[model samples]
Target: MRRRAADYRRPARRRLSCWIWGLLVIFSVAGFALFVLHHNQHQEDHVEQTALETNTKNERVVHKHLNFTEEILSVRSYARQLAEQMTLAKAYVIIAKEHNNFHLAWELSSKIRSCQSLLSKAAKKNEPVSLDDAGPIIRSLSSLIFKAQDAYYDIATTMITMKSHIQALEKLANVATVQSTVFGQLAAESVPKNLQCIYIKLTAIWLEKNSLRELADERRNSLQLVDNNLYHFCLFSDNLLAVSVVVNSTVSNADHPKQLVFHIVTNGVKYGAMQAWFLGNDFKGATLEVQNIEDFSWLNASYSPVLKQINDEDLQRSYFERTKDMSLEPKLRNPKYVSLLNHLRFYIPEIYPLLEKVVFLDDDVVVQKDLTPLFSLDLHGNVNGAVETCLESFHRFYKYLNFSNPIISTKFDPQACGWAFGLNVFDLIAWRKENVTALYHYWQEQNADGSLWKLGTLPPGFLAFYGLTEPLDRRWHVLGLGYDLNIDNHLIETAAVIHFNGNMKPWLKLGIGRLVCSTSNSHYPEKLSTTLPQIINGSMVIDAKGPRRSLKVRRKMSSLKYAIKGNQFKIRHDIVVSIQRKSKREM
Candidate 1:
């Protein structure tokens, strides 16, 4: 039994041992599999962590770029606003000086300083502004701030000088009851004797001309017809000869010459002369009506604020005396106030209320091509369509404006383009809606206390039309033809309108002669030299021993005859060709 029990126990034990071995193998396999699984899970977890870290770094870089872009945009907007404010502040400074308001100027200066400080602080942030990105703007604003400060100091100085002058005048008033008449006489004697003679002669001529004023009203009622098909041209001129040229040019260049109607406005003295010239000339296709400036009901000294501002005795005296400082041609100077005819264009809106649009031409301009195309041009809702002048070598805005005043420098771009006023297309409806006339009045009032501009109606036009100007084709208006001796003949030929902007008019003695810059041998007529003023008489006769160059010859030649004599060039018919020889000293 023990042996049998032992065998049974042994088999059971064997079975149990086998079961235990199998269980152990299963446990080992399970353990290995679990270990492999755990290793794979750990690798995945490490990859996910790495990916998260990379994503976070990328996001930070993207945020930085976005922040930088936003900051740059903010800086640009701030800079533009600051520039505008600076310009206004500069104007206020001038105003303060004019009104003797030092407190306002001081307050403005302090505000400007504060703005500078804040702007500097905002610009100096680390990692906030990129030097490469914002460097240009930052530098410009910084420079502008410095310039504005300097302008403030200049204003202060001007104010001080003005105050001194006022005090001196007050002292003089107290000191001179007895000596006043003698002092006045002495001052009168200080004027150049030649200048005094010329002034007196000119005044006499004007007085004599005025004595012959015609009571006959111009034939304006006949010209204004119900038909809307006629092409209208408006002009304000005192020169009958110039008017004849303009009318002839216009009539010849038009496709429908008979359909043209010229609305001519002149002073009381010139109305009769203008009508006589027009009638005698016989423009077969064109019709013109001459009206005196006094005929315009809305036009008076009280109508425009600009007129009121400049109508003062002191202002008129200053303007008349400004010729010396302005370096104007002595012959062009007038002892009286600036011509009221110059200010007439400002009333274009009221002058032609029934007309929708019109092109305003300066008397100095000569029309070349057909101007009917001007009527067809799209103004893009602008009140004025004109050629930009800033592209020219000399006719920049800075050439016209006083940039030393912060107001001028800050408010306007020194490089901001300016337009020529000689040929302008005005949209009357747009002008009325924009209230441009009112804007013109406001600026004129600002300039009332102190002279804001040096000369001309164009500056006021620039301010009034500011953003409302549309840039026309440059070929439409070619400028500086009178003063720019070096202008290309091809440009003149191609231009729609040729403008003689300076003192040397084509009608002047030397004007047409100087058109051609180079010549070999030019013969000038002796009579042409006589046409020149006394001031220029001696200079016109060239020294033949040195070089046979320019001799003021005033002989009338119907056609130019060119003949070459060896190295010498001869121009027949009194056409004076002045050649400027290169000096040996210069070489």
Candidate 2:
């Protein structure tokens, strides 16, 4: 009985222990599952927080880029406004100086300098400037300008009533006129060093080559010169590059290049260089004849009043040398007044007597279209066909001729329309019948002392061809490319010829930037490339690779070889190839 009781106790104890172990296992599994769920929730929260932070950073970078672009745009706008204001300030300063208001000029200039300083600082800091920063100063300047203008107007009105003041004003006017004359004289006479270098280089090239001496003597197309059936164009110039541009532009635009005849008359000094340039290059089968003006023995001082004027020592001193008296008329000091080339237009009848009609082109002009149609135009018995320059009657006969001279006042009306000389079609038949050369000579003699008119060929030309000029279409020749910056681009493109008839010649450093592009498009002498880098502003070192020779240059070289060798087949092939290449480029 005791043994059986002990076995029952042991079994009960074992069952109790087993139940406790099962509860422990269940608790452990539940705790582990809860821990895993808690960890997964924490990790998901961390991942969401990281994505939000990255998105914010990306947005900040994009916003920064946009802000930077806006700042750049704002800076450009500010700069443009500043430039305009600066220009206005300069004009105001000029006016103040002219009126002897030095205090106002100094004040305005100081303000402008301060504005410039602010701009520089802003630019250095890469900060955008606001136009409003200059607003208060500009408003103050405007008010000052208005006040000064009012004061001047009052003074002008007061002076009109006072006799003594009027006399003083006249004296002041005379002084101002004299000062202006001196300024103009200096401006016109001063030749830039670059132009001098070009002239020297071209002349030196001619002098160096003995083979180029007989270049202009070639008579290959002598009969075509006087052939009335062909188009005859005459140019009188001393500038080799200018002549080249005129010839090149003409030949490039011509419909029938073979029928073109160009007769260039230059001074004795430039004859060799002019001849060498023309002979070295081919003008697309156009006949080019260069004549030395000194060769015409009949164009002596005894017969030509201009030659006499050129020979006068007093005239030479007054024109070529500086003097203490600034009162000399600016026109009197112009070297062009003494140039035989300037006066040669009057002797065109004598120069090409055989040609019944001819077109005269100035060296400064660029032909834009085929000039063959000009020869076919009828003059209706007029000696000259020209574009009238009297849109507002500003360029009337009175503008050129002195109305005080009875010979001019009685013969020509002040309101009579004037014509330009740069481009003209001359009727040699009528010119000879009217003895126009004698008329020109008579007018030239009358103006020898320069009392009748200013010292330019235009005045004499106006007198000689007073009633004999036929008005041409203004589109045929557009003027003011040199001086008028506001000329329409469409007008320039559509015009047959554009004239650079002012001080800002296309070749000069001071030439208008846009106008220079027109001339730069034409082929320049290869030597010009080497010399141009020397004169170009800023850098002294030449380009190591040198300028790339243009396709036009290669074509020109090929044409030159053909001209020398007289290879008809090769020239024809080259022309075809050039035409095809040009067509492909256009396409």
Candidate 3:
């Protein structure tokens, strides 16, 4: 009986073991299935994300291509219109000559000459000509056609000849359209005649013996130049009036004018004029120092990529001269890429070795508010404090760098934000610790062939200061006053500084009318008007006692005086006040 019972218990135990083994097998299979499912889902998610990014990139390329195509089409249309008007004008000129109408011929010839002048400007500037520009010739040609018909001047034959001319021009227009596009892309910036005239007159004044002798006087506040407790500003520029405006505006808006110090560094060619302007003018109680960049014996080809490029004759020709290849990039031809002054901002640490921090201002900027508060802003261990330009996404690293290069692709992010250079608060202590200049040198050496980047100092700035820049509020610096037209007026009014960072400088005739007023409203040195008068017909007459009087001479003098005192035709409020006081006294 005992043996039978033990056999029964053993069989029961075997059944229990079988049940446990089956349960373990079922749970293991379930866990493996769940793991496989999750792995597949993660891979799908990654592929989807990659596809989305690729599509976005393709869309941006397509949009850019569309914009380029539209520009070409508009240019072609304008060319055809201009060609038609020119042909019509030529036919009218022939009819007038044949009829021996001297006055009519002269009038038509004058209109033709004016059209030719406009064509010359359009060709040289690489700017598009509008139908409205040919309005005068169109009207003259229409009136002449009526007169020719009345006089039986073989109008039909003239029309036939004009048709052939128009047809020939149409063919040439196609070639011109392509050339115009290329020229437009590679247009080089040059000093305007008015600015060149100003510079010449200022230099003449600078050379005069005993003229602006006050500039040679030593300042008692010279010790404040490198004072870390004070608000220090550095300006790197060649334009005298621009520097004056910058200094004047800064001084005018400062909370403690005596606490401000400006260190200006310009090229050797403009040092005399720059020094003379600042010396002749007063900026409340602010300290000003002007130094020549050429005096810096250390800043040579061995230290600067731009200096090396300038020393290369092949690079100079490629940058300044027109090339026939349409494939050449536009930025490669920009002359500013070779200018040492444009790249001087990178060497601020070396320029002022003693300053712990600085607020660097571009010559094209105007200060509207006190900037002393900028010094107190915490940088959180960053080297640069700048206004980020990446709100539009066009200013990201991908836009400025050659991402196709393996070095750039592997080391940096394409979508990282970019910052502006025109207005920056640099922490010199942090900058030195990070050796930012050495980093800039390394990248610049890597891009010695101009492959890693295309143009401007901002690209290298982006690389050297990556992850080391703290973004400031946009209100600190408002940009696009030079090129963008649709910026909000409220934003401009509230901004601490307004920057004209593009081709249209406020001092140039090409500057936007409204934006120029905003710049002109800022204070400039009073001596600027007296020292450098307005230029008329490419000549400047510097008469300290004002011009002599005839009825016509007085009229010209009145306009010129208005221009000089009013700061380029925009009358200042202070000038208006003086006029009001004079009227009261006369009454």
For each candidate in turn, give its C-alpha RMSD to the true structure in angstroms: 24.8, 23.1, 28.5
What TM-score does each of the candidates earn? 0.50, 0.63, 0.62
Better of 2 and 3 by TM-score: 2
CA lDDT for candidate 3: 0.70
- Please, what are the lDDT tens digits per residue for candidate 2 over residues 129-188? 544464455455545544544445555433443445457779999999878766755665
Q: Model 3 over residues 114-161: C-alpha lDDT tens digits? A: 767776666655554444564444445445544545454575777776
The per-model lDDT (C-alpha) reads: 0.59, 0.70, 0.70
Model 2 TM-score? 0.63
Misplaced by over 4 Å in model 1 are 1-218, 223-228, 318-337, 403-411, 512-587
Q: lDDT of candidate 2 vs native?
A: 0.70
Tens-place lDDT digits, model 1, residues 1-587: 45544453557788899999999999999999999989866765554343233223222232333343354344233433444455556555555666677776776676666555555665554233223333334344344434444445676665665576668878888668435543433342243333233233223333444332341233445545223456677788775545555666666667777777787888876655455445433465476767788777676667677667557776576545543453443322343126777777777778777777877888767676789888888999999999998877556667666778776677776666888888888888899999898888887776665445665677778788889999999999988866687877777767888887765564454355544233333211121122222222222222233332222222111111333222111232221221122112221
